[model samples]
Target: MFDKAFQRVNTFEDFRTELVEGKENRAGEELIQESRKKQKVDDDKETTELKQCLEIIPDEEEVTIDAIPLAVKSPRIVDWKIHKEGTKSYYQIIRADRKSQMYMIFSHMLKSFEREHLEDLYKLVKARYGSTRPVESMDYLLWNDMKIMFELHVEDEVWKLQQGYKVLEWKLYDSCGVHSLMMQSMQIYMLVEKKYPLTPPTLSMMLERSFKLIMKVKWLISCVN
Candidate 1:
Protein backbone atom coordinates (compact mmCIF):
# COMPACT_ATOMS: atom_id res chain seq x y z
CA MET A 1 0.00 0.00 0.00
CA PHE A 2 2.94 2.40 0.75
CA ASP A 3 4.86 1.35 -2.40
CA LYS A 4 3.90 4.65 -4.07
CA ALA A 5 5.53 6.66 -1.24
CA PHE A 6 9.05 6.55 -2.78
CA GLN A 7 8.47 6.39 -6.60
CA ARG A 8 6.49 9.66 -6.60
CA VAL A 9 9.18 11.69 -4.76
CA ASN A 10 10.61 13.73 -7.72
CA THR A 11 11.31 17.27 -6.36
CA PHE A 12 12.89 17.57 -2.87
CA GLU A 13 10.70 20.58 -1.87
CA ASP A 14 7.48 18.72 -2.73
CA PHE A 15 8.63 15.63 -0.87
CA ARG A 16 9.54 17.72 2.21
CA THR A 17 6.19 19.51 2.06
CA GLU A 18 4.38 16.16 2.14
CA LEU A 19 6.64 14.76 4.85
CA VAL A 20 6.16 17.69 7.24
CA GLU A 21 2.60 18.80 6.37
CA GLY A 22 1.08 15.32 5.98
CA LYS A 23 1.74 11.60 6.55
CA GLU A 24 2.45 11.00 2.83
CA ASN A 25 6.22 11.67 3.26
CA ARG A 26 8.51 9.42 1.19
CA ALA A 27 9.60 6.39 3.23
CA GLY A 28 13.32 6.35 2.37
CA GLU A 29 14.85 9.38 0.59
CA GLU A 30 12.72 12.22 1.94
CA LEU A 31 13.02 10.94 5.49
CA ILE A 32 16.81 11.15 5.40
CA GLN A 33 16.75 14.68 3.94
CA GLU A 34 14.25 15.85 6.54
CA SER A 35 16.35 14.39 9.35
CA ARG A 36 19.43 16.29 8.13
CA LYS A 37 17.52 19.58 7.87
CA LYS A 38 16.10 19.21 11.38
CA GLN A 39 19.56 18.47 12.79
CA LYS A 40 21.00 21.65 11.18
CA VAL A 41 18.25 23.76 12.71
CA ASP A 42 18.89 22.38 16.20
CA ASP A 43 22.63 22.97 15.83
CA ASP A 44 22.10 26.59 14.76
CA LYS A 45 19.85 27.25 17.74
CA GLU A 46 22.42 25.90 20.20
CA THR A 47 25.21 27.99 18.67
CA THR A 48 23.21 31.19 19.06
CA GLU A 49 22.29 30.45 22.67
CA LEU A 50 25.86 29.67 23.67
CA LYS A 51 27.04 32.98 22.25
CA GLN A 52 24.43 34.86 24.26
CA CYS A 53 25.28 33.10 27.51
CA LEU A 54 29.06 33.64 27.34
CA GLU A 55 28.72 37.31 26.39
CA ILE A 56 28.36 38.16 30.09
CA ILE A 57 30.59 41.01 31.22
CA PRO A 58 33.44 40.33 33.65
CA ASP A 59 33.10 41.83 37.12
CA GLU A 60 35.75 41.86 39.86
CA GLU A 61 34.48 41.06 43.37
CA GLU A 62 36.35 41.52 46.63
CA VAL A 63 36.93 38.10 48.21
CA THR A 64 39.36 37.21 50.96
CA ILE A 65 40.26 33.55 51.60
CA ASP A 66 43.76 33.53 53.04
CA ALA A 67 45.69 36.52 54.37
CA ILE A 68 46.70 37.08 50.74
CA PRO A 69 45.66 40.39 49.27
CA LEU A 70 43.30 40.73 46.30
CA ALA A 71 46.03 42.43 44.29
CA VAL A 72 47.09 39.79 41.76
CA LYS A 73 48.37 40.38 38.24
CA SER A 74 45.93 38.88 35.76
CA PRO A 75 48.04 36.15 34.21
CA ARG A 76 46.92 35.98 30.59
CA ILE A 77 45.57 32.61 29.47
CA VAL A 78 45.32 31.75 25.76
CA ASP A 79 43.94 29.10 23.43
CA TRP A 80 41.80 27.56 26.14
CA LYS A 81 40.43 24.23 24.88
CA ILE A 82 38.37 21.76 26.87
CA HIS A 83 37.89 18.11 26.01
CA LYS A 84 35.39 15.86 27.79
CA GLU A 85 36.19 12.18 27.50
CA GLY A 86 34.20 10.50 30.26
CA THR A 87 33.04 11.67 33.68
CA LYS A 88 36.11 13.92 34.03
CA SER A 89 37.34 16.59 31.61
CA TYR A 90 40.81 17.10 30.18
CA TYR A 91 42.03 20.61 29.39
CA GLN A 92 44.83 21.71 27.08
CA ILE A 93 46.08 25.16 28.13
CA ILE A 94 48.40 27.82 26.74
CA ARG A 95 49.60 30.89 28.64
CA ALA A 96 50.77 33.94 26.70
CA ASP A 97 52.38 37.06 28.14
CA ARG A 98 53.97 40.32 27.04
CA LYS A 99 57.47 39.40 28.17
CA SER A 100 59.12 36.27 26.81
CA GLN A 101 61.07 36.10 30.08
CA MET A 102 58.14 34.40 31.81
CA TYR A 103 58.02 31.71 29.20
CA MET A 104 61.81 31.26 29.24
CA ILE A 105 61.77 30.78 33.01
CA PHE A 106 58.98 28.22 32.77
CA SER A 107 61.12 26.16 30.42
CA HIS A 108 63.70 25.97 33.21
CA MET A 109 61.25 24.05 35.34
CA LEU A 110 60.69 21.50 32.57
CA LYS A 111 64.45 20.86 32.31
CA SER A 112 64.39 19.54 35.86
CA PHE A 113 62.61 16.53 34.41
CA GLU A 114 65.24 13.85 33.71
CA ARG A 115 62.83 11.14 32.69
CA GLU A 116 60.62 11.30 29.64
CA HIS A 117 58.04 9.43 31.67
CA LEU A 118 55.33 11.34 33.55
CA GLU A 119 55.43 9.17 36.68
CA ASP A 120 58.92 10.42 37.43
CA LEU A 121 58.20 14.12 36.88
CA TYR A 122 57.43 14.73 40.55
CA LYS A 123 60.50 12.73 41.60
CA LEU A 124 62.72 14.85 39.35
CA VAL A 125 61.60 18.16 40.92
CA LYS A 126 62.38 16.90 44.43
CA ALA A 127 65.81 15.65 43.41
CA ARG A 128 66.80 18.91 41.77
CA TYR A 129 65.52 21.12 44.61
CA GLY A 130 66.88 19.47 47.74
CA SER A 131 64.99 21.16 50.54
CA THR A 132 66.32 21.44 54.15
CA ARG A 133 68.61 18.34 53.98
CA PRO A 134 65.90 15.63 53.68
CA VAL A 135 64.38 15.21 50.20
CA GLU A 136 61.08 13.38 50.35
CA SER A 137 59.49 12.00 47.19
CA MET A 138 56.72 14.27 45.88
CA ASP A 139 53.23 13.11 45.01
CA TYR A 140 52.38 15.19 41.91
CA LEU A 141 49.08 13.52 41.12
CA LEU A 142 48.00 13.84 44.76
CA TRP A 143 48.39 17.58 44.33
CA ASN A 144 45.13 17.42 42.39
CA ASP A 145 43.40 15.91 45.44
CA MET A 146 44.42 18.99 47.44
CA LYS A 147 42.78 21.16 44.74
CA ILE A 148 46.21 22.21 43.48
CA MET A 149 46.11 23.14 39.81
CA PHE A 150 49.49 23.99 38.27
CA GLU A 151 52.83 25.22 39.69
CA LEU A 152 54.89 28.15 38.41
CA HIS A 153 58.02 30.09 39.39
CA VAL A 154 60.80 31.96 37.59
CA GLU A 155 63.88 30.85 39.54
CA ASP A 156 64.53 34.12 41.43
CA GLU A 157 61.97 36.50 39.99
CA VAL A 158 58.48 34.99 39.87
CA TRP A 159 56.80 32.05 41.62
CA LYS A 160 53.10 31.20 41.81
CA LEU A 161 50.72 28.24 42.00
CA GLN A 162 46.96 27.80 41.67
CA GLN A 163 44.50 25.40 43.31
CA GLY A 164 42.25 24.25 40.50
CA TYR A 165 43.89 22.29 37.65
CA LYS A 166 42.63 25.36 35.86
CA VAL A 167 42.81 29.02 36.93
CA LEU A 168 39.76 29.55 39.17
CA GLU A 169 38.97 33.18 39.95
CA TRP A 170 35.86 35.21 40.71
CA LYS A 171 34.88 37.72 38.08
CA LEU A 172 32.37 40.48 38.84
CA TYR A 173 29.11 39.86 36.98
CA ASP A 174 26.50 42.55 37.35
CA SER A 175 23.71 40.30 36.11
CA CYS A 176 24.19 37.63 38.80
CA GLY A 177 22.26 38.42 41.99
CA VAL A 178 25.40 38.68 44.13
CA HIS A 179 28.03 40.03 41.72
CA SER A 180 30.38 37.36 40.46
CA LEU A 181 30.75 33.70 39.59
CA MET A 182 34.17 32.13 40.06
CA MET A 183 35.42 31.08 36.64
CA GLN A 184 38.13 28.45 36.35
CA SER A 185 40.67 29.13 33.62
CA MET A 186 42.30 26.36 31.64
CA GLN A 187 45.61 27.78 30.39
CA ILE A 188 48.83 26.57 28.76
CA TYR A 189 52.29 28.14 29.19
CA MET A 190 54.86 28.38 26.45
CA LEU A 191 58.49 29.55 26.53
CA VAL A 192 61.55 29.54 24.27
CA GLU A 193 64.00 27.08 25.83
CA LYS A 194 67.79 26.81 25.71
CA LYS A 195 67.28 23.06 26.24
CA TYR A 196 69.82 22.54 29.07
CA PRO A 197 69.22 25.01 31.89
CA LEU A 198 69.81 25.40 35.60
CA THR A 199 67.29 24.21 38.17
CA PRO A 200 64.72 26.99 38.63
CA PRO A 201 63.12 27.61 42.01
CA THR A 202 59.53 26.35 41.98
CA LEU A 203 56.79 27.52 44.38
CA SER A 204 53.21 26.41 45.05
CA MET A 205 50.29 28.58 46.22
CA MET A 206 46.87 27.35 47.30
CA LEU A 207 43.79 28.89 45.65
CA GLU A 208 40.87 30.10 47.73
CA ARG A 209 38.08 28.83 45.49
CA SER A 210 36.89 25.45 46.71
CA PHE A 211 34.97 24.06 43.74
CA LYS A 212 33.90 20.44 43.70
CA LEU A 213 32.35 19.25 40.45
CA ILE A 214 30.53 16.55 42.38
CA MET A 215 28.94 19.08 44.72
CA LYS A 216 27.89 21.25 41.80
CA VAL A 217 26.05 18.31 40.28
CA LYS A 218 23.92 17.88 43.41
CA TRP A 219 23.18 21.60 43.51
CA LEU A 220 22.15 21.55 39.85
CA ILE A 221 19.77 18.62 40.39
CA SER A 222 18.12 20.50 43.25
CA CYS A 223 17.54 23.53 41.03
CA VAL A 224 15.76 21.38 38.45
CA ASN A 225 12.92 20.76 40.91
Candidate 2:
Protein backbone atom coordinates (compact mmCIF):
# COMPACT_ATOMS: atom_id res chain seq x y z
CA MET A 1 0.00 0.00 0.00
CA PHE A 2 2.91 2.42 0.69
CA ASP A 3 4.84 1.65 -2.51
CA LYS A 4 6.96 4.71 -3.66
CA ALA A 5 6.67 3.86 -7.38
CA PHE A 6 6.75 7.53 -8.62
CA GLN A 7 8.58 10.68 -7.38
CA ARG A 8 6.38 13.45 -6.02
CA VAL A 9 5.24 16.12 -8.54
CA ASN A 10 7.40 19.33 -8.61
CA THR A 11 6.12 22.29 -6.61
CA PHE A 12 6.60 25.84 -8.12
CA GLU A 13 9.66 26.65 -5.94
CA ASP A 14 11.12 23.11 -6.42
CA PHE A 15 10.78 23.39 -10.24
CA ARG A 16 12.51 26.81 -10.27
CA THR A 17 15.33 25.43 -8.06
CA GLU A 18 15.81 22.42 -10.37
CA LEU A 19 16.00 24.74 -13.45
CA VAL A 20 18.60 26.85 -11.66
CA GLU A 21 20.62 23.73 -10.72
CA GLY A 22 20.46 22.45 -14.31
CA LYS A 23 21.71 25.84 -15.59
CA GLU A 24 24.58 25.82 -13.06
CA ASN A 25 25.71 22.35 -14.29
CA ARG A 26 25.71 23.41 -18.02
CA ALA A 27 28.42 25.50 -19.80
CA GLY A 28 27.30 29.09 -18.94
CA GLU A 29 27.51 30.54 -22.50
CA GLU A 30 25.59 27.84 -24.52
CA LEU A 31 22.93 27.03 -21.88
CA ILE A 32 22.15 30.70 -21.30
CA GLN A 33 21.74 31.21 -25.08
CA GLU A 34 19.37 28.19 -25.41
CA SER A 35 17.26 29.31 -22.42
CA ARG A 36 16.90 32.77 -23.96
CA LYS A 37 15.61 31.26 -27.27
CA LYS A 38 12.97 29.15 -25.46
CA GLN A 39 11.85 32.18 -23.45
CA LYS A 40 11.47 34.24 -26.64
CA VAL A 41 9.27 31.56 -28.28
CA ASP A 42 7.00 31.50 -25.21
CA ASP A 43 6.79 35.32 -25.17
CA ASP A 44 5.79 35.34 -28.90
CA LYS A 45 3.05 32.77 -28.26
CA GLU A 46 1.63 34.85 -25.41
CA THR A 47 1.61 38.02 -27.53
CA THR A 48 -0.22 36.18 -30.33
CA GLU A 49 -2.84 34.91 -27.86
CA LEU A 50 -3.40 38.40 -26.50
CA LYS A 51 -3.79 39.84 -30.03
CA GLN A 52 -6.36 37.16 -30.91
CA CYS A 53 -8.37 37.90 -27.80
CA LEU A 54 -8.37 41.64 -28.52
CA GLU A 55 -9.42 41.12 -32.16
CA ILE A 56 -12.75 39.59 -31.09
CA ILE A 57 -15.16 42.55 -31.05
CA PRO A 58 -18.81 42.36 -29.98
CA ASP A 59 -21.61 42.99 -32.51
CA GLU A 60 -24.14 45.86 -32.31
CA GLU A 61 -27.97 45.89 -32.60
CA GLU A 62 -29.38 45.66 -36.13
CA VAL A 63 -32.61 46.48 -38.02
CA THR A 64 -35.10 43.68 -38.76
CA ILE A 65 -38.30 42.95 -40.73
CA ASP A 66 -40.59 43.91 -37.86
CA ALA A 67 -40.35 47.72 -38.30
CA ILE A 68 -39.56 50.03 -41.27
CA PRO A 69 -39.93 53.75 -42.01
CA LEU A 70 -41.45 55.25 -45.20
CA ALA A 71 -41.39 58.51 -47.18
CA VAL A 72 -44.97 59.86 -47.19
CA LYS A 73 -47.28 62.33 -45.46
CA SER A 74 -50.72 62.03 -43.82
CA PRO A 75 -52.67 63.79 -41.06
CA ARG A 76 -54.08 60.65 -39.46
CA ILE A 77 -50.68 59.33 -38.44
CA VAL A 78 -48.96 60.52 -35.27
CA ASP A 79 -45.29 60.87 -36.19
CA TRP A 80 -42.79 58.27 -34.89
CA LYS A 81 -45.48 56.14 -33.24
CA ILE A 82 -45.73 52.39 -33.83
CA HIS A 83 -49.36 51.40 -34.31
CA LYS A 84 -49.35 47.72 -33.33
CA GLU A 85 -53.00 46.90 -32.67
CA GLY A 86 -54.61 47.38 -36.12
CA THR A 87 -51.91 45.53 -38.07
CA LYS A 88 -48.97 43.35 -37.10
CA SER A 89 -46.55 46.25 -37.54
CA TYR A 90 -48.02 49.60 -38.54
CA TYR A 91 -45.87 52.73 -38.41
CA GLN A 92 -46.75 56.41 -38.70
CA ILE A 93 -43.75 57.61 -40.66
CA ILE A 94 -42.52 60.99 -41.89
CA ARG A 95 -39.78 62.18 -44.19
CA ALA A 96 -36.58 63.09 -42.38
CA ASP A 97 -36.80 66.62 -43.81
CA ARG A 98 -40.45 67.31 -42.98
CA LYS A 99 -42.01 66.16 -39.72
CA SER A 100 -45.21 68.18 -40.30
CA GLN A 101 -46.30 65.59 -42.88
CA MET A 102 -46.58 61.94 -41.88
CA TYR A 103 -47.82 58.62 -43.32
CA MET A 104 -48.46 55.01 -42.38
CA ILE A 105 -47.51 51.57 -43.76
CA PHE A 106 -47.89 47.91 -42.72
CA SER A 107 -44.74 45.78 -42.68
CA HIS A 108 -45.74 42.13 -43.03
CA MET A 109 -48.71 39.87 -42.38
CA LEU A 110 -47.08 37.68 -39.74
CA LYS A 111 -45.66 39.20 -36.58
CA SER A 112 -42.53 37.13 -37.10
CA PHE A 113 -41.32 37.00 -40.71
CA GLU A 114 -38.17 35.50 -42.30
CA ARG A 115 -34.75 37.05 -41.62
CA GLU A 116 -33.65 36.28 -45.17
CA HIS A 117 -36.13 38.88 -46.41
CA LEU A 118 -34.39 41.46 -44.26
CA GLU A 119 -31.04 40.51 -45.80
CA ASP A 120 -32.50 40.99 -49.29
CA LEU A 121 -33.82 44.40 -48.34
CA TYR A 122 -30.48 45.36 -46.84
CA LYS A 123 -28.72 44.46 -50.08
CA LEU A 124 -31.25 46.38 -52.16
CA VAL A 125 -30.86 49.50 -50.04
CA LYS A 126 -27.09 49.23 -50.13
CA ALA A 127 -27.17 49.02 -53.91
CA ARG A 128 -29.55 51.95 -54.37
CA TYR A 129 -28.11 54.46 -51.90
CA GLY A 130 -24.50 53.25 -52.11
CA SER A 131 -24.98 52.96 -48.33
CA THR A 132 -27.80 51.96 -45.96
CA ARG A 133 -27.93 55.41 -44.34
CA PRO A 134 -30.53 56.92 -46.73
CA VAL A 135 -32.96 54.15 -46.02
CA GLU A 136 -31.67 53.14 -42.62
CA SER A 137 -35.10 53.80 -41.16
CA MET A 138 -37.14 53.04 -44.30
CA ASP A 139 -35.70 49.71 -45.49
CA TYR A 140 -35.38 47.74 -42.25
CA LEU A 141 -38.97 46.62 -41.77
CA LEU A 142 -39.86 46.64 -45.45
CA TRP A 143 -42.10 43.99 -47.04
CA ASN A 144 -43.19 43.33 -50.62
CA ASP A 145 -46.67 44.75 -50.00
CA MET A 146 -47.05 48.41 -48.97
CA LYS A 147 -50.09 50.69 -48.83
CA ILE A 148 -49.73 54.49 -48.52
CA MET A 149 -52.12 55.60 -45.76
CA PHE A 150 -52.54 59.06 -47.30
CA GLU A 151 -51.19 61.17 -50.11
CA LEU A 152 -47.78 62.80 -49.65
CA HIS A 153 -48.06 65.94 -47.46
CA VAL A 154 -51.86 65.90 -47.40
CA GLU A 155 -51.67 68.29 -44.44
CA ASP A 156 -49.90 70.95 -46.53
CA GLU A 157 -52.53 70.56 -49.28
CA VAL A 158 -55.33 70.90 -46.71
CA TRP A 159 -53.95 74.31 -45.70
CA LYS A 160 -55.35 75.77 -48.92
CA LEU A 161 -58.86 74.70 -47.89
CA GLN A 162 -58.25 76.18 -44.49
CA GLN A 163 -57.41 79.53 -46.11
CA GLY A 164 -60.75 79.40 -47.99
CA TYR A 165 -62.63 78.83 -44.72
CA LYS A 166 -60.84 81.82 -43.21
CA VAL A 167 -61.99 83.97 -46.09
CA LEU A 168 -65.58 82.72 -45.56
CA GLU A 169 -65.34 83.60 -41.87
CA TRP A 170 -64.27 87.15 -42.79
CA LYS A 171 -67.27 87.49 -45.17
CA LEU A 172 -69.67 86.12 -42.47
CA TYR A 173 -68.52 88.85 -40.06
CA ASP A 174 -68.96 91.56 -42.70
CA SER A 175 -72.52 90.52 -43.80
CA CYS A 176 -74.75 88.91 -41.16
CA GLY A 177 -78.01 87.51 -42.78
CA VAL A 178 -78.93 85.14 -45.66
CA HIS A 179 -75.62 86.08 -47.35
CA SER A 180 -73.58 85.04 -44.31
CA LEU A 181 -75.58 81.79 -43.90
CA MET A 182 -75.01 80.92 -47.61
CA MET A 183 -71.31 81.68 -47.20
CA GLN A 184 -71.15 79.29 -44.20
CA SER A 185 -72.80 76.55 -46.32
CA MET A 186 -70.28 77.23 -49.12
CA GLN A 187 -67.42 76.77 -46.68
CA ILE A 188 -68.99 73.49 -45.45
CA TYR A 189 -69.11 72.21 -49.06
CA MET A 190 -65.48 73.14 -49.47
CA LEU A 191 -64.66 71.22 -46.27
CA VAL A 192 -66.40 68.15 -47.76
CA GLU A 193 -64.42 68.49 -51.01
CA LYS A 194 -61.16 68.88 -49.17
CA LYS A 195 -61.68 65.66 -47.25
CA TYR A 196 -62.93 63.30 -49.98
CA PRO A 197 -63.09 59.52 -49.43
CA LEU A 198 -64.13 60.45 -45.93
CA THR A 199 -64.71 57.91 -43.20
CA PRO A 200 -68.29 57.49 -41.91
CA PRO A 201 -67.56 59.63 -38.87
CA THR A 202 -66.02 62.42 -40.95
CA LEU A 203 -68.93 62.35 -43.42
CA SER A 204 -71.41 62.54 -40.56
CA MET A 205 -69.61 65.55 -39.11
CA MET A 206 -69.66 67.30 -42.50
CA LEU A 207 -73.38 66.60 -42.95
CA GLU A 208 -74.18 67.92 -39.49
CA ARG A 209 -72.30 71.15 -40.12
CA SER A 210 -74.05 71.63 -43.45
CA PHE A 211 -77.46 70.85 -41.90
CA LYS A 212 -76.98 73.43 -39.14
CA LEU A 213 -75.99 76.11 -41.66
CA ILE A 214 -79.09 75.32 -43.79
CA MET A 215 -81.37 75.48 -40.75
CA LYS A 216 -80.02 78.90 -39.87
CA VAL A 217 -80.64 80.18 -43.41
CA LYS A 218 -84.25 78.81 -43.38
CA TRP A 219 -84.90 80.50 -40.03
CA LEU A 220 -83.73 83.83 -41.46
CA ILE A 221 -86.02 83.39 -44.49
CA SER A 222 -89.02 82.63 -42.19
CA CYS A 223 -88.33 85.77 -40.10
CA VAL A 224 -88.51 87.87 -43.27
CA ASN A 225 -91.73 86.14 -44.37
**lDDT winner among the candidates?**
2
User: Over the stretch 202-224, how does candidate 1's per-residue lDDT look in tens digits?
Assistant: 11111234345547778999999
* Overall lDDT per candidate, in order of appearance: 0.36, 0.39
**Model 2 C-alpha lDDT per residue in residues 1-225, reported as the tens digit of each score:** 234433333322577888898887776778889999999999999999999888654577553566445522222212244445553545434323445322343222112212332233334434554523333343443311111111213343333343333222312221111111122223221211123333354445446766778899999999999
Reference-based lDDT, residue 13, model 1: 69
Error of 2 at 120 (Å): 44
Off by over 4 Å in 2: 1-195
Highest TM-score: which candidate?
Answer: 2
In order of listing, the candidates' clash counts read: 10, 1
TM-score of candidate 2 relative to the true fold: 0.18
